[model samples]
Target: MRMMTCRLCGSDDLTGVVDLGATPPCERILTADQLDEPEVTYPLHLRVCTSCWLAQIPPLITPEETFTDYAYFSSYSASWVEHARAFVAGLDLRPDSFVVEVASNDGYLLRHVVERGVRCLGVEPSVNVGQAARERGVPTVTAFLTPESAQAVVAEHGKADYVVANNVYAHIPDVIGFTEGLRTLVADDGLVSVEVQHLLTLMQLNQYDTIYHEHFQYYTVASAQRALASGGLTLVDVELLTTHGGSIRLWAAPSGAPSQRVSDVLAMEKAAGLHDISGYIDFTERVAKVRRDLLSFLITAAEEGSTVVGYGAPGKGNTLLNHCGIRPDLLPYTVDRNPYKHGKFTPGARIPIFEPERIAADKPDYVLVLPWNLRDELIDQLSYIRDWGGRLVFPIPTLEVV
Candidate 1:
C-alpha cells in the first residue's frame, strides 16, 4: 500500500504481477465470535525489481510487529529440531561456548545446546514464546532484534560464539539493521548462520504461497551476499538444505574470511541464472501454467460431484489454499498430523481441520496434498486412503494425481 521499493536492491522500479485478491493474514485464524467482523487486507501483489532481480510483496508490517507475537513454532516440523541439534553438534560447542538464536520459539534448538553444558540465550520477540523459552531454561530477551537489542544482549550474556537465525532472514523488513545486530552480538571470530528459503525454488516450483505480508523479501544467495555485505559481513559458506523445498544456509563472518563453499555456490547460482531477471520472467510463465492447471483440475472435480479433502495444515498450505481462492466449497476440510493444529481452522479460507484418522471415516475421493513440498512423506502417511478407493492430488509445480 505504501511505497514499493525492493528491499534487496533498493530499487524503486517495480512492475505489478499477480494479485491474490484481498485477504487476511494467513495465520490469523478466527474464532466463531470474530467471524462477523471485517478483516485487514493489504495488496497481495507480486513485483519484480528491474535493478535487483528480487521478487517480493509489499512490506505492510514491520519486523517488530510480525515477530513480536509469533504463532508459527519451529518444533512443529519433526526434522527441524534434529536439524538445529545437528547444527550445534557440528559447530564443536564447548562448555563455555555461548550460542544464541534470534527469533527462537519454545527453545526448540537452544535446549539441545544447553543440555550439552553450553550456555545459551534466545532473543525471542514474542512475549508468549519468550516466556516459554525462559521456562525451559533458555535465557531469553523478550524484545525485537535491533542494534539496541543486540547491545543489551551482549551486556547480559557476553558476546556469542555462534548465532543462528533459521528461516527468519526473510521475515525482517530492515535487513541492514538486523545484520548490524548480528555484527554487534557475535564475537569477531564467531559465526552467524542464517537459513532462508531459496527464491529460485519458489520460482521453479511456483510456490506463490511463500509470499506473505510477513516475508519482506524472498532471498537468494546473491541477494543475501549483498545484504550481509552492507553490515560489513561476508557469506563465507553456503549449504543447500532440503527443508522448505530447498533453502540456502549461509555462514557469514567479517569480510575476507577464508571458507570453502562461498564462490562455488555463488558461481552455481550465477551459472543457474540467479543474477538475471530473465530467469524470474521464465518462472512467472511457469507459475501461470500451474495456476491454470490447478484451477482446471479443482473445477472439474467439483463439477463431476467429487469429494475433495486436503491433507496437512502447514503454513505453506495456508498460502496455497488462500492463493488458489479455495474455500470449503472446493475443499471441505483438511487432515493434519500435528495435534496442535487439529480441531483448529485454517486462517483465510476457514477450512475445517481434522486429525489424519478422519480420512478413514470420510472416504473422500481425493485428498489434496496441501504440503506438496513433503509429498513423499505425506503420501506415505496417507497411503491408506488408496485402500478406500481414493487418490492424492498435488497442486504445485503442477496438478497431478499421485
Candidate 2:
C-alpha cells in the first residue's frame, strides 16, 4: 500500500500514532452461517503531520468501492432525523439559496431544507440512497462527489449557495480531490458547513471506536483550517456540537469571502490548545487509561454473575466490544432499535442482536449501553427496562452504572 500523506497540509511529515491491527468492517454484522467466512480487516493506524497537525489514515478504499453499495441508513435513528430537522431549521437559510449536501443519505436533512422553500441537491454515491433522496423530491446526483462531478453540478444548478457535508469528510480517500470538488461546487460567496468528530474530544473521551475504516481522517479545528486553506477555502466559523459524542460544525468559504466568525473561531481554537502538538502526544496515555477502566468494569460485572446484555448495535459498539475482547459470556445479546440489525450478529464478537422487547422477557440484570454518547436519549428510550429493576451500564471515558 502507498504511504498516506497528510490530508490537511499535503505534507508527508507524519508519524505513526497507533495501529489497531486488522478487524472486520465495524458495521458488517453477519448471520450465523455467514460468520464462517474470513473477516476483512483494514489498517486502523493513525499518523499526524508535525507541520499541519492533521491526523489521518491512508485511503484504503475509494468512495465508489465503499459507498456505491452502501448499507448505512441515516433514517434508522430517530435522533439523527431530529438532529437533521433541527440543523436545517436553525440555519438562517434564504428561500432562494441553492443547498447541496454530500452524502445526503435518503435526503434526511435536505428534505427539511426543501420544506422551508430552499432549492436543494444531494450528491450521493450510493445508488439506493441517492434514488431515495430523489424520490423525496431532493434533486440528487447518483455519483461520487469528485472534481468532475462537482463541475457538472456547477453547470446544472449554478454554484451552490450552501454546501452541507455532515460526517462525510472523513469518508473520502482522496481528500484533496474531494475538497477540490467542494471548491468548484461552492459559489464565491457561498459557505460550506462541515460536521466532523473532533479529535481533541475523541482523545479526551477515549473514543477510539470512532477510529474505524470509514473515518479516514480525525479532524481538529486546526487540522480542518489547514486542509481548507490548501484548497483555497477558509474556515470562517465553527460550533462545537454534542452530537456523536462531540463534533465540530465548521463554516468555510473562499479565502476572499467575508464572514465575521472566522477570526473569532480561530482564536477560540488557539485558546483551546488546538495549535499545540503536545496535547495529542499526551492523549495516548489517557486513551490507555480508558481501556483499563472499561475492561476492569466488564470483568467485574461478569464475575459477579450479572446477566449482561448490550443496548444499541452501533459501529462504535462493535469497536469497543472487539477491542476489549468481549464475547458472548460477558454480553449474551445486544438489542437494536433498527430492525435491519436486530436479527443479525455483531461483526467480530458475533454477539446476538435482538429487539428491545426481548429485554424484559430475558430479564437481564444489567443492560450495557453501547451508544454511550446518547446515554440520555437511550435511557429515556429504554426507561421501561427500569420497571424490571434493570440498570444501564456504559463503558467509555469511564465505566459507570446509570
lDDT agreement with native, every candidate: 0.79, 0.81
Residues 1-402, model 2: lDDT tens digits: 576677666778887766666667777778778878877777677777877777887777655656776657787667888999998887777867888999998898998987888888998889977787888888888878888999988888899888899999888867778888998999888889899998868877778878877788888877787777767788878888888999989888886543456566566656656566555665566666767887777788789887889998888888778777788887889998777676789988899999988998888888889988887778888888888788988787777887
Q: Give the TM-score of each candidate.
A: 0.92, 0.92
What is the per-residue lDDT of model 1 for residues 1-402, given as tens digits with 9 covering 90 to 100? Answer: 457788766889986545666666766655565666776766677776767666678877666655666666666656677778888788868778999899888898998888898888898888877887888888888877899999989997799989998888887878898999998888989889999998878776678777777777788777788889877788888898877888899999875563567677777767767676556556556666776787788889999999989888877777777767788888899887766566778888888888888889989999998778776666777889889789999887778897
Error of 2 at 43 (Å): 2.5
By lDDT, the best candidate is 2
Look at candidate 1 and tell me the lDDT of residue 254. 71
Q: How far off is residue 6 in model 1, in Å? A: 3.0
Clashing pairs in 2: none
Candidate 2 Cα misplacement greater than 4 A, ranges: 1-4, 256-274
Off by over 4 Å in 1: 15-18, 258-260, 337-344
